[model samples]
Target: AQTVTQSQPEMSVQEAETVTLSCTYDTSENNYYLFWYKQPPSRQMILVIRQEAYKQQNATENRFSVNFQKAAKSFSLKISDSQLGDTAMYFCAFTGRGSTLGRLYFGRGTQLTVWP
Candidate 1:
């Protein structure tokens, strides 16, 4: 079975700074997709970033980026210039291509609080 792990359960940051959320996964599937999704206070899950198993370049979106270590199956998210709106519960997810009906496996999540 595949599972995602987020060691840090809670995190905080000051406005206009930076923060990184750590994530790791255990999977035997050779090909898979990893993702970072943010759920704000409203409970809407928004994709922060994603990386294909074969992609070498770390996926980046605006102030968000990921450190993907394929061999170790580690994926961490870095948020630069953090803002109040960036506060949310971040989840690390995985979807293995080996499944006939692809399913999403999510980590427990890390709650981020951005303060002024």
Candidate 2:
């Protein structure tokens, strides 16, 4: 059983600043995938970033990046140059390969508010 945990329940940041949301997981499998999904007030789950366990380097996408520590089972997300539109509920998710294609285990959630 793989479980993701986001210690921060809520985080706020000023526009154009940077913020990092912490996430940790417990997984016995050596190979798996981690993801960060954002759901705005509209409540649509959007993929923010993803990191494969085998990849040593972190993954970055525009204003979003991830600090993936496979050994520690931690995958935190960093949002740089934040904007008001970034306000949303961020969820950390994990999925094991093989038989778990449609299955995704998510953390409680982290509500991020970007203030102008």
Candidate 3:
């Protein structure tokens, strides 16, 4: 049973600034995938970033990046140059590689609000 945890219930950041959301997970499997999904007011889940357990280097997408610590079972999302559109609920998710595809276990989520 893999479980994701986001300690921060809510976070606010000023526009054009940077914000980092913390996430941790507990998984016994050696190989798995971690993801950060953002759901705006529209309620659509969008992939922010992803990191593979085998990879040591973090993943980066535009202004979004991840701090992946495999040994600690921690994966955090860093949003740089935050924008008003970035305001949403960010969820940390995890899934196993085999037999359980597309079934993601998500955290309670951190509500992020970007102020202008």
Candidate 4:
């Protein structure tokens, strides 16, 4: 089984500010995919960004970016220009092949609040 961990249960940031959410995962597979998903009040899991295990470069999407440290098994999300619309439950997810195929493992999620 793949495991993901989000250390912070809650976080808040002012408008136009920046914030980083920490995440770590444990997996035995060498080839896999890591993702940061944002689920707003609407409860739709939006794919913020993704990183492939074999890639050395981190992934970024517009205002969202990821700090992926393969050796340390760390993948953290950094949100630039925090907006009130960004407030939501952010989840760190993992998917791989073999025994863990066809399943996505998710962290408990960190509730992020963007204050005006």
Candidate 5:
């Protein structure tokens, strides 16, 4: 079994500013996928970004980026130019490659508030 942890239960950032959410995981599997997901008030889980365990370079998507450290099993999300739309429940998730395929583990999540 794998476990993901979000140290911060909540965080706040001003509009147009930047904020980072921390995450760490424990997994014995070498091949896997790490992801950051956002769930807004609507309760839709949106994929913010993802990182393959084999990739050394971090993954980025527009204003969202990840700082993935494979050795430390850390995957942090940095949201730039934060907007009111960015306020949501952010989750750190993991999925394995082989036998555990299709199974995803998630952290409790961090509530991010973007203030105007």
Candidate 6:
């Protein structure tokens, strides 16, 4: 079984500032995918960023980026110039070889608050 851990339960950041959320996981699978998802008050799980285990370079989209350490099994998300919309419950997730199942093992999540 794969396990994802988010050490911080909550994090606060000022708008326009940068905030990094930490996540670590334990898995035996050689091939897999890591993801950071944001769930807002609407109860929708939105994809923030994703990192492929086989890729050496980290993944980034706009202001969102990830620090992926394949060897250490650490994948952290960095939000640059945080915005109010960034306030949400962030989850770290993993999917093994059977991605067709679309089954994801997720972390408890970290509640992020972007204060103005």
Off by over 4 Å in 6: 98-101
> For residues 1-116, what per-residue lDDT tens digits would candidate 1 score against the true structure?
88899999999999999999999999888888999999999999999899998889999999999999998889999999999999999999999888613899999999999999
Q: What would the per-residue lDDT of candidate 2 be over residues 1-116, giving only the tens digit for each residue?
A: 66789999999999999999999998777778999999999999999999999999999999999999888889999999999999999999999875555689999999999999
- TM-score result, candidate 3: 0.95
Clashing pairs in 3: none
Candidate 5 accuracy as lDDT: 0.96
Candidate 3 residue runs with Cα over 4 Å from true position: 98-102
Off by over 4 Å in 4: none
Q: Candidate 6, which ten residues in sequence have the lowest lDDT sum? A: 95-104
Model 2: how far is 51 from its true place, Å? 0.5
Clashes of each: 0, 0, 0, 0, 0, 0
Query: Between prediction 2 and prediction 5, which has the larger TM-score?
Result: 5
Cα deviation at 51, candidate 6, in Å, is: 0.8
RMSD of each: 1.0, 1.1, 1.2, 0.8, 0.8, 1.5
Can you give the lDDT of residue 45 in candidate 1? 99
Per-model TM against the reference: 0.97, 0.95, 0.95, 0.97, 0.97, 0.95
Off by over 4 Å in 2: 98-101
Per-residue lDDT of model 3, residues 41-76, tens digit only: 999999989998899999999999999998888999
Cand. 1 TM to true fold: 0.97
What lDDT does model 1 reach? 0.94
**Clash number for model 5?**
0
What is each predicted model's overall lDDT from 0 to 1? 0.94, 0.93, 0.94, 0.94, 0.96, 0.94
